[model samples]
Target chain A: MEAPERLGEVVQASTDRFTAQCYRLYGAPPLGSLVRAGEREPHVYGIVSSVTTSSLDPTRPVVARGASEPTEEAIYRSNPQLERLLRTDFEAMTVGHTQDGTIHQYLAPLPPHIHAFVFRCTPDEVRAFTQRLDFLPLLVGARTPPGDEVLAACLREAASAHDQPTEFLVQAGRKLALLLGGEMQRLNTILRRLPL
Target chain B: MTGREESPEVLGPQLLGVVVGGSLSQGLEVRLEDGGVVEELKVGTFVTIRGERHRFFGMVTDLGLASADPRLPSALPDTTNPAIVRILSGTSAYATMQVTPSLVVGGEETSLLLEGPQPARSIPFHFSRAYRASQEDVQAVFGAEDERHIWIGSPLDMEDTRVCLDLAEFVKRSNGVFGKSGTGKSFLTRILLAGILQRDVAVNLVFDMHSEYGWEGGSEEGHAVKGLKQLFGSRVAVFSLDEESSRRRGLSPDYLVRIGYDQIEPQDIETLAEMLNLTQNAAQATYKLASRHGQQWLREFLALEGREELAALADQLGEHQQTIESLRRRLDRLNRMAFLVERSPEDSVRRILEYLDRGTHVVLEFGRYGSDLSAYLLVANLLTRRIHDSYVRRKEQSLGDRAKEPRPLVITIEEAHRFLNPQVAGLTIFGTIAREMRKYNVTLLVVDQRPSGIDEEVLSQVGTRITCLLDNERDIEAVLTGASGARELRQVLARLEPKQQALIFGHALPMPVVVRTREYGPRTYAEFGFREQAELAREAEKDLKDLFG
Candidate 1:
């Protein structure tokens, strides 16, 4: 109810699609994990496809030089200034929108407004939305070549997000296997790379 | 509109799923609603998706039930336990269905036809709710009550829903019932016959090859099916090729119609050639025999018994003398046949035709002739030739009066593929009837196990095809090819349960439908309104007795 601690903010918006930049804090929502944005009447839904960590100010040249420290953690701990230079941002692909307590598993008539709050979808919301694997094709057939890996990551994140995530993950994995049944090698790659 | 009893609730059946996305041509995929379990929906179930302005009806082809998460292990996890089932109930569970949109109803102007909505043409509003097709929607889609609707069976989806075929359209075109052995093709045929008799739209002449359709027939489960003659006593006349045997078996045939040796036409022998395994040279000898002896080919050919005399005629005809001699031996077998009149029976063929002409159905019982392919083909071809020819002439000659007109005729034959094969299609009278049946007001209800054996042209011309389960790919292809509903029907045809289920398609109904074939046991027979006509005959007799008194 208290905005669930904003994970990110919408960076761009289109008619039915939008991209959000996550906060430079904990690891961003895994690929395929659903994230929510927008407010009031139309709440936009997206599936994370990518995560990036880069200098917040692109004009500034921030580089990590090899320090003579025993461990990498010590080097990072000693040079705390490096942490403030860059930020972690996750990108989500629009899959659907929900409004007035009704879920629409299709592109929204309007996208999330720019700078709208981005938050990880609640376990209850994920449970309600993923009742059917109808949206798998959108992630699997994404124009990007690494869509499969992204789908695998998002699926694992979704599995762990719920209390009974194991059974859900196993069933979801079986479905994923079925969808990719024709491509044994690709299916195996996704199964092997799954976060679970 | 709302207050009247005639205008019931317009809302379709209960909500089942919502369209997520899918290609239009192949079909669309629907995601189940909350608490909607995949197991609740069966294959062949019909669902409706509301479009912007129209309602799209779809038949479930494939069901999708899996984990929504790809990261789950590839090996299927055991979900047999209640805990697993509870786990399986939530959103991570993937439950979807592949549905082929078959009909579009509920627009500004409503019309129903065979054509389906074009794929990717008018896509359903994405995410719109797809409901379990309501009673009203089904009534609108398959209502044949106004037509001569023959209640054939209940749909496999719902038990109480009667799937009726428009008997008027069914009789107008040649139809076929095909299935593997023990798939209840005979039961479906019997039920269809009952409908025809009940409607009295057409006079049927069934060439009962198995003797299973006249008085009482052997059914799939070896139980008895009270035949058409029993249901329509006065309206249905039973004739037997082997009347003595029929009587021996206690079958009281209406007429013991026998065919003489003279009635065996060259073409009849020619049609039987393939079944009899006759050589090309031996088959050609029948033509030579016919050419030399106009009306007495079989008798005269058998009379030339001497090897030398046969050799001389064979040499003159440029055929093998031994082949011709063996042909004599084969023709000799018919001499011992009790049904084969050495001297022609006095106009037996005409007597059967007279029965049909009087608007009475005829079921020609074959008795012992049922198993003898040579005898079956020989007698069937000979009798059908005369009947079809006279009917053709009468149909062509008739001018105007409707009441006195020759009734539309339906000739049903079992093991039809053997007679309708490509080798004999051009020659058999059944083939000619199959082709021009509509014009001659004659159609065939061909029953066979191997539809692939029948000529493609004849198969294509069949009007309504009610097919039970068949495993043979060729048989499946044969029934599906050239049908308007072939593409989507493939799914329906594939899903028919082995026992009493069937797919009914073609001219008889608006769309192809999967049916759990109607009940036809003796106990249920009286309830199907089959005895009303027999009761009428009883009433008529009582009237005559009263008048005479």
Candidate 2:
């Protein structure tokens, strides 16, 4: 498969103007571009979603950043090991001064798949998958708007894979997907209007 | 002038205004104030003006205020306002003394005097500050600022401190919480757990039917996930139905149990057996077969190679074929009951016993488990057995040295009414625990919303009751009756709000307190929900993509 164009490099050519323009439109690049500078992994870019100052320790501040979806999942999966690194990265991005304090931030990676469906799996299947990876493929839209549809579709697909997808699962997923799409559109619209 | 000094003989009848029949003295006419002659003072307007004291204390019986001449010279003008003076009757010394020296009827300066001791000072029946446990005191005892430790929101108030308890004494031996839905019963449950955990002294064994307490502050992606593990460490063990753990061993699926037709007390059992394809004779023989083969006898009995083998065995047993056939039929019936029973592992039972033996805080997280009812019953039974065994062992050693041994463990069962059903088995293992555990130092903290649903005998055995607000009158009444000193508990219950609990009876507390539950650290079941964690993870993933990609 052909690799996508180096969009980052193409965008970087006009960094000053772009930065100035972006600052004028939205505020500061709330997150500093560490990856853009080639200091960190070139493929990885951290976006500062929020900067929270520490009330307990003035020196320690929290910077919430977005990570790639895979990276975020990894963080969750290996939480015990990654906590300090994420905390440090978050603090470095957000913290202006250092004092004895704690910082909190989420390192979420961009999702590889934009839309994924979730469905109920048999206990045996759930066990099989869960045991293999020590992590379950969580159903994202199990409760929310798109979640229900995605979950329904996922269940239907799973059932069909076994040649016995229940009619309920099939229909439920299709209907749920429509509902979920509408919810997603609404959420997107809301996010677009927000300052972030 | 004294009446004794004035002789009636000296003043003859003629002079005394009696002067034979119709005397002039009797015919004397008196002009009324309103220019109308009246025989006696008006009922409401009667006033006896004391000339000596120049004061009047009497009712303005009629509408004399409007009718009285405005131009008439008023006697004691400041005191003649009828609105300010109420008409007084039933004149006794007590009433008269209230008016005091201000009013004197005769020229001799007569005054009513009070002679006896004054009545004791009346104090309104307000709750004494000493008796009323304040939110601050409760917070001090139970509240922790850490998100992992606190159950209620910040800025704790009286609502956060409402505790329910019986009125018999300062400590409640046992109490429960029961509500239909959305009555904040779960919130109250969390508060109680948080309170106990905050003390850091008591070890809690929370059988979480619904995985509420296992996760406290950390979401699946963030703090709670890891925070829970760190905070609870070995103290908390989550036994989900989906997986086998050291603590989740030994739960037998109800279907696997051989049900004898003779053992079927109710028609429901017979129907259930029939639904499972067991003939009456087979059902009757099930008990004998199971007892002789031991507990796992059903599994071995079901493992008979084929129908041919089973038939051959039936022939070999000849006279016992009826019983064997019954057993075989009942085995088929058990398939339907598979969901109800869980085949408990020996290891899980041993692990729990180990915890009890070592006196460690163990929370069996059965929230994710499929068969909750069976899991709870099994754990309850296993714990009871271990407790009994330990007690027996300790008793044998205690005749020589009673004072030196460690006390038995205390078990806290959240949502206790679910397992301790009196209607089902007459006395559930939980009831047995309540009855027998006290002697072994194995205390039970039974938590539930419907206090009435719990077995009355078991409820009676509870020594410390910490109650929250209960809306159901029947539940309140049951709690009041079951708990000692519960007469005054209603007052506390009436005032309880969400998260507020009355600690009437407990070893540590003196009086019932409206207490804000302490903040629980991130390691409690209340904070953990698998679905919630998944959602958080999804959100985190999305945020990462938006920022980086």
Q: Which candidate should be chosen as best, given DockQ against the real structure?
A: 1
lDDT tens digits by residue: candidate 1, A62-123: 66565678887887788787777777787777777887878777778878888898888777
Chain A accuracy of model 1 expressed as TM-score: 0.78
- Candidate 1, which CAPRI tier? incorrect
Interface RMSD of each: 13.0, 44.4
> B1-549 in candidate 1: lDDT tens per residue?
001223324663667677888876777888876345577776777777888777787677777764556544554444454533433343445588887777776554333334323222365878877888775666666774543887787766678777788898899989999999899998999988888888888988998988888888886556677888777778889998877668887878888876777888778877877766778778788888888887877777777757888999888778888888877776776776688766664888789888888888899988888888788888888888888888777876675545555789888988898889999999998898898858878889999999999999999899889999988889999999797536667767777789899988887776677888888886777755666666779989999999996
Q: Which candidate achieves the best TM-score against the true structure?
A: 1
In model 1, what are the clashing residue pairs, if there are any?
A31-A154, A32-A154, A33-A154, A130-B91, A171-B67, A172-B67, A172-B68, A172-B69, B13-B134
Badly placed stretches (over 4 Å) of model 2 are A1-196, B1-202, B216-230, B239-241, B244-287, B301-346, B402-407, B424-427, B484-488, B491-495, B498-508, B519-549
Quote the B-chain TM-score, candidate 2: 0.50
lDDT minimum window of 10 residues, candidate 2 chain B: B88-97
Q: Given candidate 1, what's the lDDT at residue B134? A: 70
Which residue window of length 10 is worst by lDDT in model 2 chain A? A89-98
Cα RMSD of all models vs. native, in order, equals 9.6, 43.3
